[model samples]
Target: MLIFTNNLSENRNVFIIFLLLFYSCQGEAENKLLEVIKVKELKIKPEVLTIPNPPYVHLIESDSGQYLFYLNPNSKSLQFMNMEDGKVANEIILEYDGPNSMSRRSGIAGLENDKVWTTFRPHAIAYFNYKAEIQFKKDIPSGEVDITYVGSSFQKGLHQYGDKVFGMQPLFMNHHGMNKDDIQKHSLVYSYDMVSDQTKWYDVYYAKDYWDSGKKLSNFSWVRREDKLYIAPWYDHEIQVFDMQKEQVTIKVEAKSDHINSFYYVNEIPGTHEEGLLNILNNDLYGIILYDKYRDCFYRFFYPGFTDDEEYAIDKLWMLRNSRPFTGVMVLDKDLNIIGEHIFDKFQVHASSNVFVGEEGLYLSLNNENSPDYDEDHLRYMVVQFEVGE
Candidate 1:
């Protein structure tokens, strides 16, 4: 009896310690968030959903609400859906066989007046109309610029800054057997005005910090709200606010997560709303990959822990490269937090490198679970229905 009592007492003490540890960690997570997002009740309709096929879909809105365009890079086709009645308004097939083009590293942009733009590296931006007409093109001049991981020394950190669009170019010198390392030995940031086609340059990082094991800047998204621009730098893991008026850096805040993958500015409607998305890698393969569909969005779902041992079930198969396992989407009320999430079983979403979300549903790419190569499936993109709230 004495031995049993001693064992029980030890177990009780361990339990208490665990409870305290859990609370401490939870409290810290809450504090790290900029603000606790709050959302009202959600109403979801699960029945009204559809799935369309074609592997990848890129969506674009004119901002004037005149049209919603859908670009399918796989088939090299463009389709327009009418927002007013939710119908197929028009579509055009491009001349290029998108999949045959090995260089995804190319640059493509969409304009308001049904105009499309693409760049062919170290050169100029090509303009194409809806009829796939080559309207205007210009070649980029040789100069030092800051480049980004998106492969485009131009498109990676490029954005429209009010009256003009600004692009950054990474420094590359081909003449002297010089590589990215040598470029990093110098400065990193450059800017160009789209309207004027004028260029300006700045060193993003110091020589020491660029090559340092620590203090590397990477994976950033630029969003312009009102007159200012906010950059969510992933490797630095911080949010930087750039004031356009002052033409200087302003606010900087530490992020809540270990890393941030992507972000978008959501100000179409209004009300101090912003959202940030992150692809959090874990010690294990199955980790919580976060996303913010809207500027200020929220989602809620249960995910595997960083150290859980459920490897064989979710990790090995590579079942859904385009579909996420946890849930389809999350709804947040302005502030970013876990208010509610839309989850469906028997569906998997693995890769989100390029995804299109619309009022009708979501379009994503999919591959055969059995065959992991391009020959069998050839990157089958599909559109699935996602209904939020119940």
Candidate 2:
């Protein structure tokens, strides 16, 4: 009996130690979360005689190093600046008309072997050389009516993937009276081949019954990490993962948030042009999802719910589009599981188009239009890091 009692006591002691270690490790993991380390000021010089279009810096890699490519439509020039140095390393002034004409509505699509690919018009992609001359241009034939975004957004233009490039439509323009047939015929993304000029549309799926209520959705937010594309449509309270390799939506998750789930659908349509603009300014919308390659995590942002009655920057259209009064981000793991959430009680990030991922951490822009230090010429990013807790 004495020996049995001693054995039982030993077993209990072992179990207690095991639980202690388990909880300790669990707590440590919970602590391994997001941390805003510092705010990085990227005082980019206006060297190429062009003004920045704001919140639209294109990132590219070259043999020399990585560069931020900015296409100035006003000056008709493209400037390449190194990440470390705020000065422009190279500039290419383009021609508007002639035999080698580059369209005014062009943007940097891809860079390869001292040449850059520019997408102009709905159906054309032009290639420009280092000497600021158009080498050649090709028109991609789309059988159906397609929408190409002019400015910066997640689905700005076609991106190079292997021998093909792909693009996504952020919203449906005629979603007001969209029928079952319209939604059925809609393709989520289109893939284009430069060599063949052949375009293929993938029949991507939407979150369960996103438009069944006959309400229109707003713009979409997206983040592409290698083969996975994380898309957050403003209408649906969910985020989906599209697998580039499989060419299908592999995962659809509704990681419900405190504020996102409460977003009102676009049930009522604005009658006038001014009313349409007012609708955008007064509604809640889903922003972008930032992927941390270094940490293999995700940050999904959302514009908090508000009404037209709220008197916060309602007069300025640009201000309402980029910087909102209160915005929040929900942190998720690689599997898209919600772990934590943080709301900027004060004006900070330009949620519409000002967040990016870097080697050090996730960079949230501090150039909110409502911010006290808001400078139209300069750009600032707040570096947020994820580290294991002590």
- Which model scores highest in lDDT? 2
Q: Each prediction's Cα lDDT score? A: 0.38, 0.61
Task: Report the C-alpha lDDT of model 1 over 241-306, residue by residue, as the tens digit.
Answer: 556655555665443332222222221322321111122222111122223243222222222212
For model 2, the run of ten residues with the poorest summed lDDT: 1-10
Model 1 local distance difference test score: 0.38
Clashing residue pairs for model 2: none
Among all windows of 10 consecutive residues in model 1, the one with the lowest summed lDDT is 275-284
After superposition, the stretches of candidate 2 with alpha carbons farther than 4 Å from their true spots are 1-35, 39-55, 59-67, 82-85, 104-117, 125-127, 132-137, 143-157, 194-197, 272-274, 307-315, 386-390
Error of 1 at 319 (Å): 7.1
